[model samples]
Target: MDLSYTDVANRYRRQTLSILADERPLSVSELASRIVAHPSNDATNESTETQVRKARLALYHVHLPKLDESGLVSYTHETGEVTVPEGVADDLAEIAETFRSQMDE
Candidate 1:
């Protein structure tokens, strides 16, 4: 929890660090697309919002759970919200850029 993304071993965590650079909570579906789409492409529409992927099961079943377990985010199945806890340092935004660049590659 204390280590930065460069020091952290899990790439998923690093990827998520970048995804959450916006420092706001997002619905599960939005999180999935943000994981794959370039930041410039992050647009939310009620019709297309749920269209991030088919059924969005992978995000529900896989990624969010992994993130939730680490205490990095708060996921509420009932509310469909994934929240980034406060108090994390702003240096993480750099990790987000790094992860974004890596995703571009």
Candidate 2:
């Protein structure tokens, strides 16, 4: 499934915020693991390493760029480190809640 730019941006923003809320910059692999480990409403399958890999690529190549453009996150491609922008954590939390709610519905 193809995601629109806004969709991608929102996902990246929320993920970045969630990661940064922990107060540490994360490598791409670490970020991917966190995202996959994060609980969701979907009950059919759990996230796997391959799923994480796909998410990482999507976030790194597409979503991160948009988030960077919006100044919602700062990323260093060379080291695969990502930091969430200031004041975006609440919004990301809200978005994450909404996503979970939608999946439950």
Clashes of each: 1, 0
Candidate 2 per-residue C-alpha lDDT over 2-102 given as tens digits, one digit per residue, 9 for 90 to 100: 22457444554565555566555677777777776667513436448677887789778977777667766678888888876566655655655555565
The C-alpha TM-scores of every prediction are 0.62, 0.64
Candidate 2 ranges with C-alpha deviation above 4 Å: 1-9, 41-47, 85-105
Instruction: Provide the lDDT at 37 for model 2.
Output: 68
Reference-based lDDT, each prediction: 0.63, 0.64
Q: Count clashing pairs, candidate 1.
A: 1
In candidate 1, how many Å is residue 3 off? 5.7
